[model samples]
Target chain A: MDYRARFLVDPLKKLSLADIDPDDTGDIDKEKAAELTATYLQRMEEDQFLLYADGRQSLLVVLQALDAAGKDGVIRHVFSAMNPQGTRVHGFKQPTPLESAHDFLWRAHAHVPAAGEVVIFNRSHYEDVLVVRVHDLVPREVWSQRYEKINAFEHLLAENGTRILKFFLHISPEEQLERFKKRLDDPRRHWKISESDYSERKFWPQYIEAYEEALVKTSTLTAPWYVIPANHKWFRNLAISQIISETLDEMGLELPPTRVNIDEIKAHYHAAVKATENKKSD
Target chain B: MDYRARFLVDPLKKLSLADIDPDDTGDIDKEKAAELTATYLQRMEEDQFLLYADGRQSLLVVLQALDAAGKDGVIRHVFSAMNPQGTRVHGFKQPTPLESAHDFLWRAHAHVPAAGEVVIFNRSHYEDVLVVRVHDLVPREVWSQRYEKINAFEHLLAENGTRILKFFLHISPEEQLERFKKRLDDPRRHWKISESDYSERKFWPQYIEAYEEALVKTSTLTAPWYVIPANHKWFRNLAISQIISETLDEMGLELPPTRVNIDEIKAHYHAAVKATENKKSD
Candidate 1:
């Protein structure tokens, strides 16, 4: 299956989360999926190196998921093979007093990737529409207006050479409950199980509705959203890895052409080396 | 020699550019210097990886130099081995119309490195004091106050997690003329030779004085200035690589402690793998 076309949210089509099967793995067996995922991971690393060497464009990966939909797991498994020097992961939590004082996008804007870099947002400005609307953190009118603002913000980034990929990790409520149970049962995972994880599960339907609207409204041709069926952790990793690797491959990255004559530079390098060698004898 | 201490500007003492020899190489032969620089570069790479994994502190390297004083060469030689993904180079030229509309530091503040990253400014907020003062681009009173503003700005970055290193690559007027001649002689290098190269030469003394004051006033203990003798390109690279390696070493970076129990995480990993295997069989 062409996962990019299969999972990409069609703006014209109504975005109903119910239509997508959270457990679907495209009929690929676990071994095949893992093998494919490893290949993609290796390709992604090579593509990232070319992207950095080209030094002209940037990649921004935005990951949005429910509390137990495996956002952290996806990041670790997919990006661990890539160089940390070029990749950054920013996790947006609740706003601080200072952060709240500014506009909603101010904090996120400060961390966008520069040329030849990849930045991943564990959660992002979409929170302004998601949590802020679902929990009445802000009034309806204010949150409603933010879709345009968010779109404009992304447009500005796109215009300035940022390629954005947003993923909504779609998982069933039953799967979330099972993951939460696992966290509760494992002593090591106990720290990750919070009171809000339980309390927030009650708002599951409303949260899905909020996300559906956001995915519909903000996913543009330049910055598209991929709805990944994340109930199966291996498949989620496989799908995301494939999308990212393919996207980077399509970017047509090449090492920047040399601006100076390499022969001349080589000559100077040799002369300089000789001069240093002569100085050593002194 | 302790390059960090030897090259660090002493704030209490009067600074005289004429007193520092631009050709000094600490009596090290070129072969030995190159060998040392290569070692430092490797260490810097390792330290940067640890710094990113540690994810607590950041390093901001501010490079300031007169035209033809070898800032580009220093960056190319010293930092080429480091991962370009974790490192960013922001070269501040004349301010854009939008940039000039705001306060001087407004544009620069936007690009300061975040935690676990290294950002190198080819020219920076110091331009407000150096060029703005030397060229009389702003009124005397306006440019004079910027030293304090610049100091406070760096102080704010320091209070956060950023460790700042500012380098003033000091080259003599004779060396500048020599480099300008080399550029004119080589067609490949002609693109870098601007008309301003000659026009700016007239302001040499004024620029030196402007830089001296900025260096003295803004060189706090947290963000100190290093005056490097840059007439010889290889020596400049050696000094810079050594200083940076030592500074990162002093930062004491370590991989962050795991928040979860490794035994439980390992057990879960095995269980998850088994689940996938079982599903594949089914």
Candidate 2:
């Protein structure tokens, strides 16, 4: 199924998180969701080798989500399936003093996927516009300018061999609270809990507004943003794996052609084998 | 089944590649080698997650193999099974002008695994000792000093959370010739052939000597070398995967402990849930 159209936040299209159901699984049968996801994951494995072998184009996957919205889950289940030789995942946390000192995209630019590589940004440069705007971490004028800057930065990457994909995991406030309660109820998940969970819960509306504007402004043909309905984890995985597999298909990846003359090498091989045989007979 | 002792180049012990038969499959039944390899590969997946969650240690695997000795084969069969998010592979080829200007290890240092990462060096700094010496790319004094330089550099990495494992894919000349013949015969694999394929074969003895010395000098308690009998590809995969699995076992990998108090989060969760429920009733 072509889930790209279902989830894609099309360029210049207005985004309303409220309009999409958090539990939406589209028309796909729920029972087949897991099976479809496995098929896609397997496809990604083969596609990754092709990408590595071609050694020309690159991929940059940007994942943005609110707390408990399944960013980590998607990565653990989907992105992890890629051969590590060619895939890289970088999570952008609170800017260190060093990062805070630079322009927002400075650190991110350092980690963009090289040729034949796929780099994943977990909570990427979009944070400058989303979280910065939500929390007023920067002056209004300073943060507002970032939307255009992000578009320009992504455009620059696109001009290079990078095919950029951004996904915003969309879940409701109710769904988030349910997830938090489960985390609170489980002792093993305590490490994931932090002082900010409840405090951030208060900023739910603010985050949604920030996300809406960022999505509307930055989603482009070159670097499309998809709003994934992630209250259903199985559906989320299937949709993401499918989209990435599709992108790899679109990349036109093929192994590079022979760099040397095959006939010449074959002659050399025959001569070498004959000499070894003659020496053995002696 | 403990293949570590069978292949390990014991520290400070004199080394000789001729003594170890490259065709040797050791005592394991051939059919069982493939089955056992799958088990270890599956174990590595779980171990990889634990290592990532622990977020404390890293593993750097250096693969130095002669051409046609199955470096790519082992990587595809073994390392690719791990999650791409935490694992990385770097292949060192002939130095570009920029790389040539710097010290030999300069380019390699840039790609070492970070905390909780597993990095594979397809060809590595050992090239300084092997190729540089064999080709007289550098003077004797320059190449002679590198064994200890390599040791000191690896020791530094080991001191700072990196566990190093080096594998020398041991294959006989006959095996290499057979591999070359297969490549010559297959059009699909022609892309893998290079002009140096035949030119490099003449250096087989020199490379063996280079490898023997480098293996003896650098294999340490911290950074060990394993001589994998790679004439049989299945046995090679089995041995390399088994050694890596055992190393992970020794690392005592575990999920990090919860960072916050569960009771405090639970109280917040209840209050939040009550607020939502009361609003719904209103």
Candidate 3:
């Protein structure tokens, strides 16, 4: 099945968390998924090189998930393969006091990918809709109207040559509890488990409702959301990598055209090289 | 010779451009330099990973150079090997009108690397002293006082956990001319060769004088300058890579400690994973 077609949140239709299976891997075995992921990663690296050389388009990957939904793993395993020079990752934690002074999107806007760059946001302005709504951190009238605001912001990015991919890592509640337990099992991973994970699980249904509205409202043709089945970690990585690779490939990036007269420059360069060699030998 | 020790600007001693040989490679052939550079780059990647994991210290590399002195090349070749998740590059171009309204350091301060990241400045606040002085864009009285302001600004960053490495890519006038000619001769590189290249060559003596004063006045214990001999591109890459690798290695980074009870968490996690498996099988 075409993951983009299967996974993309159709803007015209309403989205529901129950319609997608978190554990689904489209019948592929673990090994095949891994092999496919590697292939997509290699293609991603080549596409990114052309993107950087072309110095025009930008890519922004927004990963949104409940705690323990593999946002960090997806970043480390998938996006790390690209050149560090052209890729950046910004993790939006709870907003600091200074950040809160401005509108929620202010901080996010500052780190949007520049031309010829790829930026990954571990969590992004969407938090204003998700967490802020779930916890009643902001008033309803304000949070209620953010759907259009976010769509407008993303439309602005799209108009300015940025390709955005938002992934709602759809993990089952049972899987999240299982993962949280694993963090407890491994001493080194304990830092990742928090009190909020257990407390937040109580609001799972509300969280899902919030996400459904977000995915349905903001998933436009230009900046789409992919509802990845993220219970199987390897499969999640595979699906996300495949979608990104295809998107970048479709960009049809080419090395920017040379602006100077090549023959004249080549002759001058050769003569300069010869002159340097003579000076060295002398 | 220790490249750090060899290239470090002595704080007490006045620097003279005539005293340093831009073409010197410290007796190493191009092949040996390349091998050494690769070794340092590998070490740099490992150290940067630890730094990111530790999430403690940040490193800010400030690259200052005359036009065609290889600032872009140095950033592309030397710093691209690290994880993009933990690295950022900000090129300070001619200030936009908004940026020009602020004090020179304001724009630079906004982009300093956060804890556990490395940021490279393609050109930095030092330009306020170098170019602003050489061109007399600002009065001598105004630009003259900026050296102290820069030192104070860097002192504040050092106190706040940023380790700074500033490199003045020291190239001879002849080499700058040669590089500009090469850019003119290569169609792909023509965008780099500008009218400024020819016009700026006229200020070679003034730029050197500006640089010598900036180095002598601002080189401090926390944020020192390295005057790199940049005519030999291979040697330049090798030296800068070695210094950065060694500096990060000396930081003694360790993975952050777990914040929760490991033994308790582990038992809970095991039970959860087992419950998940049973649910799947059922």
**Against the true structure, candidate 2 has what lDDT?**
0.89
On lDDT, the candidate that comes out on top is 2
How well does candidate 1 match the true structure, expressed as C-alpha RMSD?
Answer: 8.5
lDDT per residue (tens digit) for residues A101-126 in model 3: 99988999999999999999999999
Q: Estimated TM-score per prediction?
A: 0.58, 0.94, 0.83
Model 2 agreement with the true structure over B6-117: per-residue lDDT tens digits: 9999877788899999988888888998889889999998888788878899999999999989988887789877876788888898999999999998999999998889
lDDT of 3 by residue, B5-31 (tens): 998988799899799999889878999
How many clashes in each candidate? 3, 0, 5
Candidate 1 residues lying further than 4 Å off, grouped into runs, are: A1-282, B84-86, B185-193, B277-282
Error of 3 at B129 (Å): 2.0
**What are the per-model DockQ values?**
0.06, 0.63, 0.29
| Candidate 2, A101-173: lDDT as tens digits | 9999999999999898989988899999988888888999999888889989999999988999999998888
Q: If both were scored by DockQ, which would come out higher, candidate 1 or candidate 2?
A: 2
lDDT of each: 0.85, 0.89, 0.86
Tens digit per residue, CA lDDT, model 1, B1-282:
788888899888889999999999997989999999999999998898777777789999999999989887776677665655457677798999999999999999999998989888889999999898888899999999998898899999999989999999999877876676676576545444445666687788899999889899988999999999999888999999999999999998986655555556555545655665686699
For each of the candidates, the C-alpha root-mean-square deviation to the true structure, in angstroms, is: 8.5, 2.1, 4.1
Candidate 1 C-alpha lDDT tens digits along A66-86: 998988777767876566556
Q: What is the lDDT of residue A278 in candidate 2?
A: 94
Reference-based TM-score, model 2:
0.94
